[model samples]
Target: MSTLGGAGTPNPNKSFEVVQPPTDSISSLCFSPKGNYLVASSWDNQVRCWEVQKNGQNVGSVPKAVMSHDKPVLCSAWKDDGATVFSGGCDNIVKMWPLASGGQLVNVGAHDAPVKEVAWIPEINLLVSGSWDKTLRYWDLRQQTPVHTQQLPDRCYTLTVKHPLMVVGTADRNLIVFNLQNPQTEFKRISSPLKYQTRCVAAFPDQQGFLVGSIEGRVGVHHLDEAQSSKNFTFKCHREGNDIYSVNSLNFHPVHHTFVTAGSDGAFNFWDKDSKQRLKAMARCNQPIPCSAFNSDGSIYAYAACYDWHKGAENHNPQTAKNFIFLHLPQEAEVKGKPRLNTGRK
Candidate 1:
């Protein structure tokens, strides 16, 4: 257990909750690539933005913009310039909203089923969306239809993109890898290392591999290369005695490469994969942290604490559900990896 913070010990000075959070549960949170602007997609069929204003040591936010879909928005991503945001949702439509333009949301693409994830691939200059229809679609944005559609093993549960690398996790514990250079074809298809349902996946900062989180409260470190398979491993987390919770989201630090995991346990932990040690463990909140994201500079860590609907309708207490978005400035010592001790013997 890392000592920066433990369960039931939240330091008000180190973190602040964003005011005016979504009325309903939040589905996804993403920060702009070029600035402090943050966008959140929610179960209320709305997408909202906040400008995180920073002055010296204090950080705060002012609501900037809001948009809506016919149904709840599921995922969001920012364009390379950070001026535009793309969101997809239960409406089975992908909409592109250019924030700086003060323009109307445009329909860029559509899927047969609800779009579960959307991401901007700057290198290819295209927007990719994953859907429960068991397909991945690439959109050119200028055109109304997707440029191409690639089949997936099953309905996509999560998708992560990092430059030339893209990984899609789907139903039945299927994992598909794609090299964006040949964006339309599957590079490799494999089974998830974890035995349970895949909850989320995130690419390594270096794009060498990815981290997969499962419903069993475990995470798997998988490398793309077979030669590096020796380094692959799975570890348990977000568990208390006999009770376990799903690992809802995984995010990598933009600069340090260390990663953070937010879970249905209502807690988040920062871990250094290289050192195989946890850097920090955040005190658990009253609700599950359904989503999280790091800014372009990794200066701010944003997480959403709300009812994730994981345990189904019977457990959800709408009257008591808490929806909060928190911003925490992680200390270097809490996210940076420690130097490995050298033994005299080889």
Candidate 2:
């Protein structure tokens, strides 16, 4: 298959275009709801907000504000109402920040282990989080304590919540979908062909189906309703290699049927869900990708942070640890006119 952008087209290899953050190893990246800013979490225990300008321009100036954390920041999410930003970290804490006032962060720690993932449901004013503590908790911004908690058999790596429904992927290669409306309800778990852990999960824009990427470099697409049945449809994505490290990150284009994934091998791939074809593969970073996020309009611009695996290496080394902002353009086709043939040849 041709590369993501087009066939025979030269790839636009852009540099990181770095914006100074407190740390180099960014654990997560999130585009704010308004698309005016980006929130990044670093292993250095800080969350920095960068202002994004219009016209696909480079980020303006340095980060506007830095939110301090007691431990390494793991993941972050922006509220739908655009009022607050939520962050999770290794200290087992989840924080909420007011975006209007220069990004002031308020600690809302309630988990027992490192919080791995968080999502906000603005319609209900609820924040849901998944943690390495083997549990999922629901928090209401207005309250100090968790409204409810669901214990899982394994550590949760990533989670996405859509109002009353929540989907969580675990380190044990299990995908659990829960009905948040009933806090006491048992989670519906779906098993995958690959026993490796799930690194990321993303739901379809229309909530029709969802995709899950595993550490084994394989992706499975499951129909929402069929996921609970004994028989389900699961497709393996990348087969180039299967080291089972981590899928790292996954994001769907807001307006397109395509989605992109990055992983341990630094392989960035785009897939067509309808055909399940590997659309494109780009240059590998030779490092582990920690996180990736797409811009608001679902344009080509996406950013990913790589972690330094070398021992005793500087965490912020520009060469070793770098954040990539890749620009993926839409595919184009050439029109060829049919040649005319002589009707009467003597």
What tens digits encode model 2's per-residue C-alpha lDDT throughout 168-261?
8887677888766665575577775556767788876666557787866677777667555342346554344433455767787666647777
User: Lowest summed-lDDT stretch of 10 residues in model 1?
Assistant: 1-10
- How does residue 322 of candidate 2 score in lDDT? 42
Clashes of 2: 0
Q: Write the per-residue lDDT of candidate 1 for residues 1-346, one digit (tens) a residue.
A: 1111124433333477787989888999999988999999999899999999877667899999999999989999999998999999999999999898989999998999999999999899999999999999999988987799998989999999998999999999999999999987889999999999999999998889999999999999999999999989999999989989999999999888889999987788999988789999887876778999999888899998777887687866656565789998888987888776676758
TM-score, each model? Answer: 0.95, 0.81
Clashing pairs in 2: none
lDDT of 2 at 84: 73
lDDT score, candidate 1: 0.90
